[model samples]
Target chain A: MKLFQKMGAALPSAKKLVSGLLDESQPPVEEDQGGFGPPGGVLWTTPLDVLSDRPKAGLPTQSAINAPLPEPAPALPPDSPDRSEALERTGLLCTDIEATSEIGGFIGACLVDSGSGLVLAETGDGRIDMEAAAALNTQIVRAEHEVIEVLDLDDHIEDILITMGKQLHFIRPLEKSPGVFLYVALDKKQANLGMARMQVGRIESTLKM
Target chain B: MSTDIAATTEIAGFIGACLVDSESGLMLASEGGGKIDMEAAAALNTQVVKANLQAIETLGLNDGIEDVLITMGKQLHMIRPLEKAPGVFLYVALDKKQANLGMARMQVKKIEGGLSL
Candidate 1:
């Protein structure tokens, strides 16, 4: 009689469960597949005990996002000569000549090609005609060369100085770059010849082709 | 005068000396000789002088050229325009090791003062 009473009580609960499973309106319980959740599901849906967790669709794991980025390369020095900017080099040379205080009474200056009498670069006030000066000075240099050849002096010309009552002119031929020279003009009263010569030498040493 | 040329020739290490008419590129008188051809040197130096004069005129500095000195490794060339004769010049070349620049300049100036033409 007791066994029959227990069966009768369990039969009602079993019937309710069966009805709930068969109902079409009720949602099915989703099984967690070893932490490999369904598409578009949360990444951490798997429990810690799951051993075969697979990557979720279209998403990176936490480790990749936290990885450090590669470092940037080192920078170059500002005034390194290895840099290959030709125009900048010429511009800086002119700036250096303009800023040097040792070349007093600085009326004007130019770099000239001795062969063709062409002005490669020039900087100065409008009072001085650098083009004419370059062309004429080229003739002077050529004449000197001829004299040297005729005399067979077995020497090289370092520099030439033309002194006038009111002005002084200098022409220094470049030893490394033949057929080129530096021409500078200054006022006699304001310039120191020795200092100007030294400054010109320094400038020539640093000039690039 | 001939005596002035003699004095210029007597300077130590004097390789050559010439009186040039820079306006015409002519050598009026020449003394001493080594490897340099005085005639050619006179004509070439005249071109240098003319170029200098033109440069000064173009710049409009209203200045007269007094002298031009060319420094070389083994030699020194000096070109001085005659004060009395505006178009004339004295050209001299000397060995750098044997010549004293100050003394050479003084002697050249003295010769110029005594020169007749």
Candidate 2:
């Protein structure tokens, strides 16, 4: 008798799955209908009932909503140093120009942006107008480049030396830092050209971009 | 004159050389210019010479220029005015890697001594 009861319970769904319109007495699958509520019939059922029965994917559950908030974003790095100060330390270009002053017979030294003809940094006595020199020297550099272009000299300028009666003006375009140059004015009598060139090259190597 | 200028090629690391009349900014002779336009260089280098002279006068340095040296990443350029011939100058370009600046200077001086024009 129990086997007959089990077969009776399974017969309707088996017939419904086999033939879509075979069962007129049974209504469509629904939550309250109980037609495909559990066990074997649940396999052929729509996803609506399954999703409502359990939590939807990716949404917060009751426990997740009740749990403590995530430690307040890790507390903003206690005593974060001023950004400009850090930048200043990282960019040693200005301070590096200062080292040029130690060169023998140094009258003035300035770092110029070749593209804009602006003085990025300057140090030395007030004998030379650093701003003017920066702008004018930019022209000199451009002229040299033009000459190179016209001459088809497949090369770049390392440095230019203007040996005056009393002073020697040295201009070096930084190899690592393109579009920027170092200008150092030295007393011709006191400064050794070879040594000064070596020193400038060393400083250029040490420059942190 | 071109043959006289060609003597500069004997210098170590010699690239190109020319003799220019600074007043006219024209080349009297040129040799081994490679791809370089020696004519333009002659004219432009004259400007450099003139500028240095003007700078000396303005500063009241009362000193005559020995030479103007342009050191490049790949090449070295020396502009020396002829003592015997006023308004004429010698310009030479050399490979920086192989050039001995002192020796190159001496060679330029020697060549200048022999060059009469």
Candidate 3:
């Protein structure tokens, strides 16, 4: 089918980026294993208690890409707030990449929650169905944990790139804690997969939670 | 996409009217979708999406589905299932004139992986 062909075309480039990720010097298998295992499985706690523990985590008190207010202090905070910030960061990240429209359609993008099928973040046009979209993408964070395990591929799937038609879809999973993965979606139509992989790669390096 | 919410807003806004993440009940990006309760709409639609995925698994059709659509007399519900993540879905509502159904569905399918989610 046409879709398979596009996915085939983009695979190699995505594979190359994975090979060249930030911690690539180690080994492909261990690339996404930075803070392996959640210290406390903190990403899903309720908002109230999570907010109370903010100061301890070293993250901004109040956040959002469009928050009008100055960024608050950064201390070791709790989980939910950190997750909000992560989601907010993802929104800001796409702003920076600046994918233009006039060019053509994007590849594919998704923000998948590996743990409970929760899409923490995502951005893409209209081609794929959201119902099928989120369930299909298996790239980032905790979502791919099982895939990696079952497939016998020991590496952590920081990002998985698949090309369809002329576009490329980049699935980058974020490690919020042990159990939660912040999913990031990207469109190859307006995105340069090479640069996109690297751009998101940098964001991962500076993550706080 | 969370990355370019503003751009997505301006762009998607120009197209259909609004976009919202069906799960987690958040507006990841939106262009236009009339006076619909993006949150409630997303929540209710979860059933439609869930059934399809379950069907795929039950039928052993693991070929991977990209997007699906539900058309009503008044509106069209565009559902895109991300190929990367397993259970999340992007729900977009369009006011017929605001978008070209065929193109919007195609565009949503095409723009899946610019964000790293």
DockQ of each: 0.53, 0.33, 0.02
Q: Between prediction 1 and prediction 2, which has the larger TM-score?
A: 1
Give each model's whole-structure lDDT: 0.72, 0.72, 0.42
lDDT of 2 by residue, B1-117 (tens): 322877899999998999999999999989897867889899888877776665455545466766778887688999888777757899999888999998998899888877777
User: Quality of candidate 2's docking, in CAPRI categories?
Assistant: acceptable
Q: Compute the DockQ of candidate 1.
A: 0.53
lDDT of 1 at A138: 91
Regions of candidate 3 where Cα sits further than 4 Å from its true position: A1-209, B1-33
- My TM-score estimates for the predictions, one after another, are 0.67, 0.66, 0.31
lDDT of 1 by residue, B32-102 (tens): 86878889889989988887887778767788987898988888888988888869998988888898877
lDDT of 2 by residue, A98-208 (tens): 899889999998888899999877998888778877877787777777777777776888888876657888888888775898888888999998899899888766654
Question: Residues B1-117, candidate 3, lDDT per residue (tens digit)?
Answer: 333323333323232323334345455555443445555555555544554445345434444446544333334445665566645666655444455655665666555554335
Q: Across the candidates, what are chain A's individual TM-scores? A: 0.54, 0.58, 0.39
Candidate 3 contains a number of clashing pairs equal to 100
* Candidate 2 chain B lDDT trough over 10 residues, lowest sum: B52-61
Q: A114, model 2: CA deviation in Å?
A: 1.8
Quality of candidate 3's docking, in CAPRI categories? incorrect
